[model samples]
Target: MAEAKAEFEVEFVGACPLWRGFEDQLAVALGAAAALEQKAGAVAVLLGDDERIAALNKSFRGKDGPTNVLSFPGPRVDPGFLGDIALAAETIAEEANSQGKSFEHHAAHLAVHGFLHLLGYDHDEPDKAEVMEARERAILASIGIADPYA
Candidate 1:
């Protein structure tokens, strides 16, 4: 049987508009990520700001502050639905600037990171983190982005 291509649906809620063509960027990122290449499903992406993401972080993960990205896995009722990934634009921009990375590259990395989480990849342990980071590096490289962990 042939593998199914993953789909992405993006919705901009707040400061996400700071970067134009974000949806296209996400499409390219997901397209280059091999993890999604053989998966049959749709991923929902919400582009928001720090405040919004912080609220989600608190409500779901019980975190106190804003994070760059958060991933919520969907139920298996519909196998075609992968899950939801939320992004904080302001937080991402700050991190990118501090880390000497382009906003686009940083955002792409976060998107891939969240997608990996949805696919059962976690970094709670050193071994697992190494594996996840390796996969992320390869995926970003395919799209001409440098190693995010470097």
Candidate 2:
């Protein structure tokens, strides 16, 4: 199989402070993944407060509230690289606090999660969860973050 030409672009659209070296780390994560065939389009990362994200959640997924991260795969997922990833600042902060992890760590984990989604990984089933999480663990380890499971 041909190596993926993964391309990444991250944007912070709200008050969330950009994590240290996050962009670089995200690029590394994209580079490490073999399944997401990267191409020309950028993978946008937007950070918003609860209200903004909640609206998006409700509109797109039919959920009633904000989520930590939402992945909107571009139309080209089947033949090439995936699309956009949106993250919520408030949710991420709350989740990191609740999970006893650093903000950077949780954000990194989410970034990996979003990227994996772009690669067609989903957690809707036990077997799928296993496969996706394993890939996440490996990629995150390469970036110096601990296994999200442990």
CA lDDT of 37 in candidate 2? 37
What are the runs in model 1 whose C-alpha is more than 4 Å off?
A: 1-15, 34-37
Error of 2 at 77 (Å): 9.1
What's the lDDT of the predicted structure labeled candidate 1?
Answer: 0.83
State the C-alpha lDDT per candidate.
Answer: 0.83, 0.72
- lDDT by residue (1-150, candidate 1, tens digit) is 996645544444444567567778877786666343466567778888888899999999899999999998889897777788899989999999999999999999999999889889999999999999998998999889999988
Clashing pairs in 2: none
Q: What count of clashes does model 1 give?
A: 0
Q: Model 1 Cα RMSD, Å?
A: 2.5
Model 2: lDDT to the true structure: 0.72
For model 2, the superposed segments whose C-alpha errors exceed 4 Å read: 1-41, 77-81
lDDT of 2 by residue, 1-150 (tens): 997654445444555454434556556655555334333445666666678779889999999989998888878534433677777777888899999998777877887798779768999999999999998898788768898889
Give residue 9's lDDT in candidate 2 (0 to 100): 51
Candidate 1 clashes between residue pairs 3 or more apart in a chain or in different chains: none
